[model samples]
Target chain A: MGKLVYLYGIIPEGHDINELWDPEKSAIEGEDLPYVEDFGGLAAVVTKVSEDEFGETAMEENSNNTAWIQEKAFHHHEALLELQRHTTVLPMKFGTIFESVESLKQMIEEKEEHLQHTLQTLEGKEEWNVKAYINPKTFYERVAEANENVKAKREEIEQMSKGRQYLETKKLDKFIEEEMFKDQEKKAEEMYDRLAGYSEDSERKKNWKKDVTGREDEMALNSAFLVVSEDLESFLDQIREMEKEKEEDGWLIEATGPWPAYHFATMEE
Target chain B: MPIEQSTRSDSIVDVLELVLDKGVVIAGDIRVNIADVELLTIKIRLIVASVDKAKEIGMDWWESDPFLNSQAARKEVEDENRELKERLEKLENSMASDRTQIGEDNK
Candidate 1:
């Protein structure tokens, strides 16, 4: 048999544990409440899963099929959210399991000061995601219109550099790539400026090489805005208007939101 | 009531990142030992120039060979795994050689 996985999150002061979780539904709920530790600031939502059910072997076998991994991870993600409705929770990543309840308690004790500090920093803040995707066709057309010099150069190269067509094409491609990147950065900055007033701290999403979205160009800018809960509607409205303006020129601007502040939380190394 | 389709499937507010990145990083065993595997296997993400390119690649997979069948599929998976292992070994060896060279240079 395997050990239990303890969950950690922020919960309100004097929050009833029973109302937040049944614990009976956990895979190892019958064993114990797995020992809940108090930090005086927020309650840690802890639970355990059977070892055999989620061993390294399971991960190995499932890694080949991406769908299986997302399914399990998403389940864990939702479970964390179930705890969030009660309090402003700084959700842990999907696979944060510990060996024993005592070890988890020890970790909380060790990091209690830092954890409490993180929670305090995130008070009344919600995370919103803002993504900007380039509609290649529209963006390219805009680029052609914006850069007359490059366009004329391309024509000249096409007629004169027939022998070195590949080289000419390479030069033209480089010029186009640089301009596109510049515009993307400029647009992202403009959006950031518009939203900064509402956010405590904002961050760009990590650009890992993944094939989730149907775009090859590094997701132009994936940002997380930590906005005050009261400003949620206005923040969203601003995004809608910004998206419409960009959309007229073929930029796919999108925003999603009002979730627990995930990006604002940071570990003090 | 019929399920209402979401206009946008992916949400900007990634709750998982919040909890994982900002939440407490408890060093424990309830977590799987294979976190690296989790990163690699979470999706069959294929990056392409466009949606059409992605579809073409998807269709092309069927034309490649009989790798979809249970037997062939298992073999293909094993082959891919082995290739990754070999690539990792090669990278380590190169890194080791570079380190050794650096040590000599330090002398």
Candidate 2:
């Protein structure tokens, strides 16, 4: 059976990989060769996988296979979660398989300094993703009820003929959409600013659409926050506070994780 | 290694977001040169779109949100309910064997 090296992460030397994760719990069944390879001071957490499935051409062909992608994605995260429990993992993006151990180590040596610095920066902090969704039901009702323009249009529309009322109602929806966008921006920025205070670093991410979020409400804010373990309580407390405060204003704030710092571990020069 | 016992929730989208979209990009020998993050994201988006279409045909994807429209949402709930009932039946069977322990604990 041909084998390939699949890297899950890199970390500074000290850990015994054997004690870090259980082979019985390995993502892929009937695999026994997950190990740590020391390169200078840093160690690469890796495993031997079947070259047939993970080789360059095979991965490309399988990339669009939903069942395959789902399996890989789930297993990759599961392995990392175990690794993350034991150390500050400079996580390799999924599918970082190598033709051989030699090339993987060569890349590690070439980027050792940058990788080390990234590890230092990520040492104590974990990432939490925050998303704010606009609740259409209450938010639109409140905004429409409060706006002078909407109030005026309501009275004006009451006096209009049926044909004109239909047009005005369509116009009213367009007006509310504009109002919602402007309000969403202001509220999201304010909330992001407040959330940023409790974290080491923060970044704004692209908001997911309703189709992606699978929620009826629209996503207005997508952000990642790196919070130290000590600051996590306060960070979450702030989210809880915002979740309650923002609801009346049509926002639902959710904070998820204590994840390995996916955002902060980037080694881009 | 700071691997805690904490269980972080992630949908398939979140897994794709973290695993595919972000991380250290040491180029691999495999075709998955996720070095181009934007391209991979577009590819993932296409996959997600197909997943949505699958849901339309009554195919269920694991980690799907329960917030789909009424018909789909009801279907998701029904699926979950069936699974829960099966689990409840198994638990009831196990309880028959563990009745003495339960009686002792209840006291």
Candidate 3:
């Protein structure tokens, strides 16, 4: 049960980070609070974790414990976010722990060059997430309403006998679905490009499925944008306007964050 | 066709996806490959990656992804249920007619 260093993230050196702790602020499960470790030009935000807790076997076990991982991951996100507010941060993956400070420092020393570049690139920029959703039932219904073929088919079906009408109705549904697929592709691409315009760098994040989002609507696009802090409003403004324009078509746009550039927190240019 | 059981809440999915799946990787002395944490992907569930990756993972649901234009997933379920109902009706109606023919033959 020796102590290990769990790295939250890295930031530039020399900022007085004392404000980060509220001597009264509670720690996660009575664990030691995070502290800044000076690595010369760069600093690492870390906390003391127990070897028996954050060790590989523990991580493997905890990762499966839904309640355990959720709380820990949220705390990890919050920690990086706190640092991000004061200075640019290069967030580390969850459960990054070292047996000793020496090994952690060595790893930082190796990646310091890229880390610095990433910080520079991230300065004053916030990572914002934009998730777009479309309700298929609504989309289909609306598409059917405006679609000329659907209207023509409805009239033709009205003229058919009961048995014929059943088959015709099915054919109409199949046709609507085909048209909706094409529309989904086109609409998804257009929305992505439109939102990407507001950010300096954008990553196409995978849209989580129903099982994760806990919603019935399909997520067409889940994207992250590295938006300049100043232009955040414009990014959100676009989202609002887009939703307003398409709400009836069952389009839903969700904007979340000021997140700690997790997607762009890489050494790669 | 399937919604695997999940105890994960909605709020934590994005955070875990980013920090667990996307953040910078620095090899630590006592490393954890999150993949070993089976719950990693399951917790995040069906992150509709590119169509190619979706296929690679055998997540072919998107092909007929009953949901279109991102209505979340509800609309698709509703639409699918409706379609299924309609098809069932058509089948039942045809069966009824077949029953009538049997009645005549029985007579």
Report the number of the highest-TM-score candidate. 2
Considering every candidate listed, which one attains the maximal DockQ? 3
Task: Give a tens-digit lDDT track for model 2, residues A164-197.
Answer: 9999998998787777677778889988999898
**Top lDDT: which candidate number?**
2
Clashes of 1: 11
Among incorrect, acceptable, medium and high, the docking class of model 3 is: incorrect
**Which ranges in model 1 have alpha carbons more than 4 Å from their true place?**
A22-36, A39-41, A54-68, A148-174, A208-210, A215-218, B1-107
Candidate 3: tens digits of C-alpha lDDT, residues A45-121: 88888867677787767665544665577667666656666677888778778888999898888878888888898
Per-prediction DockQ, in order? 0.17, 0.17, 0.18
Model 1 reproduces a share of the real contacts of 0.34
Arranged by lDDT, best first: 2, 3, 1
List per-prediction Cα lDDT, in the order shown. 0.54, 0.69, 0.68
- Please give, for residues B1-107, the per-residue lDDT of candidate 2 as tens digits: 11122243465566667777543334576546332333333334333444454567665444343112323433444444444454344433544677333323222
C-alpha lDDT (0 to 100) for residue A117 of candidate 1: 76
B3-106: candidate 3 lDDT, tens digit per residue: 11111112345667777764323446776755422234333332332335444645444344311222333333343444445434443354467733322332
